[model samples]
Target: MTALVIIPTYDEAANLAWIVERVLAAQPQLHVLVADDGSPDGTGAIADALAAADDRVHVLHRVSKQGLGSAYRAGFAWGLERGYDTLLEMDADGSHRPEDLAQILAASATGADLVLGSRWVPGGGVVNWPWHRRLISRGGTLYARLLLGLDVKDATGGFRAFRRETLERLPLDQVASQGYCFQIDMTRRVAAAGMDVVEVPITFVERERGESKMSGAIVREALWRVTVWGAARLVPRRLRKGPRPEPESLASRPGA
Candidate 1:
C-alpha cells in the first residue's frame, strides 16, 4: 500500500530532521510528510531542504501555529487527495520512536482498519518520564477508556496508523480536539464505526528537546468533550448503532 507518515511540528527544529531520516530509513515504502506550523527556528526551511533532497520527503507549511488536530486534518486531506492508501500520525518531538513504525505497519496489514502503537500494552513501555507525567498519562488513558466505553488500553496515544477508507469515513470535520485528545477522539470514532482496531506494543521516549504542547485548557477540553460524547452514547444498547466493547475485556488486556 502507498503509505505516508504525517508529523505535526511547531518549533521542533532540533528533532525534525533526525526523526524524518530515521522514519525514512525504517521502511522503504513509507513516505514522510512534515507539517510545520511556521516554526521560527527554521523548521520549515529544514523541511523544505529535506523535501528537496529526497523524493520521499514532503512538506506542508501552514501560515501559523494551528492546533495539532488542524495540522493533522490538513495533512490527511493532503494525503487523501494524492491517493495514499495508508496514513499514519506521529509527533515530531521524538516521543514516538521511528523504528516502531514497522510493527505498526505490520498490524495494519493484518486487515485492521486502525493500528495503535500503545505504551500500555504488553512489551510496551515509557522511558525518562517523571512519576507525575506517568500518572497523568495512565490516568488520562483510563479516564478516556472508561468514559467512552473503549476497550483499548492506550486510546490517547498519538502513534497510530489508519487505513485510507477509515480516515475518509471518519467525521474529521467534527473533530475539534486540539491536543493529544485528538487521538482519543479519533479512536472513539473508529470504534463507533465498527472498524477493526488493533493495538501493538511501543516504547515511548520522552522528548529530550523542544517544548511540550500540553496545557490545562487542552486537558479540560478533552474531559468536557469525552464526558458529553460518553453521555450521548450511554442512552441504550439498541439506540447506539455499533456494539460497545465489553468493559470486562479490560481484565485480559496486557497492561490494563
Candidate 2:
C-alpha cells in the first residue's frame, strides 16, 4: 500500500525535521508531505531542503497560516491526485508518535475505512499534559459524543488514517471547521457514511519544542460549531436543508 502521511505545520521549524524523519523511518511504505503555511520561521525552506534530499519527502507550501483543516484538505487533494491509496493525518509538533503509525496503518489495511489513534482508549493515555488540558480534551470529547451520538472515544484526536475511497465518498468541500473541531467534523462524516472506523490506543506526548497552536479561539470555535451541528442533527432530515455553499473567497489555496 502506498501511504502518504500529511504533517501540517505553522511556525514549527523546531519540530518539523525530527518528526518527519521519525515518520519516514517508521515504515518504508510511508511517504511524508510537509504542508507548511507561510511560516516566517523558514519552515517552508526546511521542507524544501528535506524534499530535495529525499524522494519520499514532498512539500505543500501555503501562502499564509491557514487553519489545520485547510492544510489537511490541501494535502488530501494533492495525495489523491497523485494516486496514493492511503492518506494519513499527523502533527508536526511530535504529539502524535510516529512509532505508533504502523499499528494504525495495519488497522486501516484490515478493511477499516478509517483508523483513529486514540488517547482515551484502553491502552492509550497522554504524557506531560496538565490536569486542565486533559479535562478540556476529555470534556470536549464527552460533550461531542453525547450530543452527536458518536461511539468513538477520541473524536477530536488528530492522528488518523483514511482510505482514499473513503475520502472520495465524503463531501470534502463542506468541511470548514478548523483545529479540534476539524477532527470531530470528519469523524461525524465518516460515521454518517457508515464507514468502518477503528480506534487504536496511542500515547500522546506533549510537544517538547515550539509553541502550541492551541488558542482560546480554537476551543471556542469547536464548541460553537459542535453545538450548531448537533442542533441541526435534531431536525428531521426531510425538514433539514442541505448545507449552504461557503463563499469561494473563504476557500484556502496553496502558495505558488
Candidate 3:
C-alpha cells in the first residue's frame, strides 16, 4: 500500500533534513511531505532543496505559521487528491523516530483504520524526558481517555497512521483543535465512528536539536477544550446546543 507521512514544521531547520532522510529510508513505499509554515530560518528553502533532490520528497508552503491541525489537514488533502492510500502524521523534530514507522505502517496494512505509535503501551517508553514532562503526557492521555471514553493507551500521541478512507470519513472540516488537543480530538472522532484503532509500541526520544514547541497555552487549551467536549456529552439531550466548533490556531507538537 502507498503511504505518505506529513511532517509539520515551524522552525525545524536543524532537524528537517536529518528526519526526512531517515523517514525515506524507513520504508520503500513511503513518501515524505514537509508542510512548512513560512519559517524565517529558511526551513522552507531547505525543504525546497530536499524536494528538488528527491522525487519522493515534496513541500507545502503556507503563508505563515498555522496550527498543527491545519498543516495536517492541508497535507491530508494533498495526499488524498494524489490518491495516496495511507496518510501518516509525524513531527519534524527527531523525537518521533523513523525506525518505528515500519511498525505503524505494518499495523495499518493489517486492516487497522488508525494506528497510533504509543509510548504508554507494553513495549513502548520515552527517553530523555524529565519527570514533569512525563507526568504531563500521562496525565493528559488519561484525562482525554476518561472524558472521551477512549480505550487506547496513547490517545494524545502524534505519531500516527491513518487509512485514506478513514480520513475521508472523518469530519475534516470540523477538526479545529491544535497540538495535543488535535491528537485527542481525532482519536475521539475515529472511535465515535466505530473505526478500528490500533496502538503499537514505540520508543519516543526527546528531540536533541532545535527548541521544543510545547507551551503553557497549548496545555491550557487542551484541558479546557476536552472539558467542554466532555461536558457536552453529559448535557440533557433536549437542552443541549449543537456541536462545538473545532479549535483552530497556530501551534506546534510537544511530546504529548
Candidate 4:
C-alpha cells in the first residue's frame, strides 16, 4: 500500500535530518512530508535540502506557526491528493521511534482504520522523563478518557496512522486543538465516526535536542475544547446527524 508520513516541525533543526533519514531508511517505499511552520532557525531550508536529495521526500513551508492542527490538515491534503492509502503522523523529535512506523502500517493493513503508537500499553513505557512530566501525561490522558468516554490508552499521543478514507471523513477544518489537545480531538472524531481504532505499544523517549513545544496554553486549550465538544454531543439526534461532505470534494474547496 502507498503510505505517507507527515512530520510537523518548528525550530527542530537538530532533530529534523536524523528523523527523516531514519524513517526513510526503515521504510524505503514510504513518502515523507515535512510540514515546517517557517522556523526562524532555517528548518525550512534544511527540509528543502533533504527533499532535493530524496525523491520520496516533500516539503510544505507554511507562512508562520499556524498551529499543529493546521500543519497536519495541510499535510493530509497533500497526501490525499497523491492518492496515498495510509497517512501517518509523528514528531520530528526523536521521541517517536522511526522503527515503529512499520508496525503501525502493518496494523492499518490488518484492519484498523486508525492506529495509535501508545506509551501506556503493556510493552510501552517512557524513558528519561521526570516524575512531574509523567504525571502530567498520564493524568491528562486519564482525564481525557473519562471526559470523552474513549477507551484509547494514549489519547494524546502524536504518533498515529490513519486510513486515507477515515481522515477524509473527518471534518479537518473544524479540528480546533493545536497542541496535545489536537491529538485527543482527532481521536475523538475518529471514534465518533465509528472507525476501528487500535493502539500499538511503543517506547517514547524524551527529546535530546530542542525544547518541548508543550505549555500551559496547550493544556488549557485541550481542556476547554474537549469540554465544549463533549457538551455539544448531548444535543438532539436530528441536530447532530447532519449530512457530511466527501473528502475529495472538501479538499477542492478554497483554503481546505
Q: Over the stretch 1-256, how does candidate 2's per-residue lDDT look in tens digits?
A: 8999999999988998899888888886689999999999999999999999999999999999999999999999999999999999999999999999989998988979999999999999999998988988999899899889889999999999999999999999989999989999999999989988899999999999999888999999999999988988887785687777876663464542
Clashing residue pairs, backbone N/CA/C < 3 A, model 3: 176-247
> Model 3 off-target regions past 4 Å?
239-256
Clashes of each: 0, 0, 1, 0
Deviation in Å, model 1, residue 158 alpha carbon:
0.4
**What is the alpha-carbon lDDT for the whole of candidate 3?**
0.92
Residue 256 of model 2 has an lDDT of 22
* Tens-digit lDDT track of model 3 for 15-112: 99999999888775689999999999999999999999999999999999988989999999999999999999999999999999989989999989
Q: Give the backbone clash total of model 2.
A: 0
Which pairs clash (backbone N, Cα, C closer than 3 Å) in model 4? Answer: none
Q: Give the C-alpha miss distance for residue 16 in model 1, angstroms.
A: 0.7
lDDT for 13 in candidate 4 is 94
Work out the TM-score per prediction: 0.90, 0.92, 0.93, 0.90
Clashing pairs in 2: none
Instruction: Give the distance in Å from residue 82's predicted Cα in candidate 2 to where it truly belongs.
Output: 0.4
Ranking by TM-score: 3, 2, 1, 4
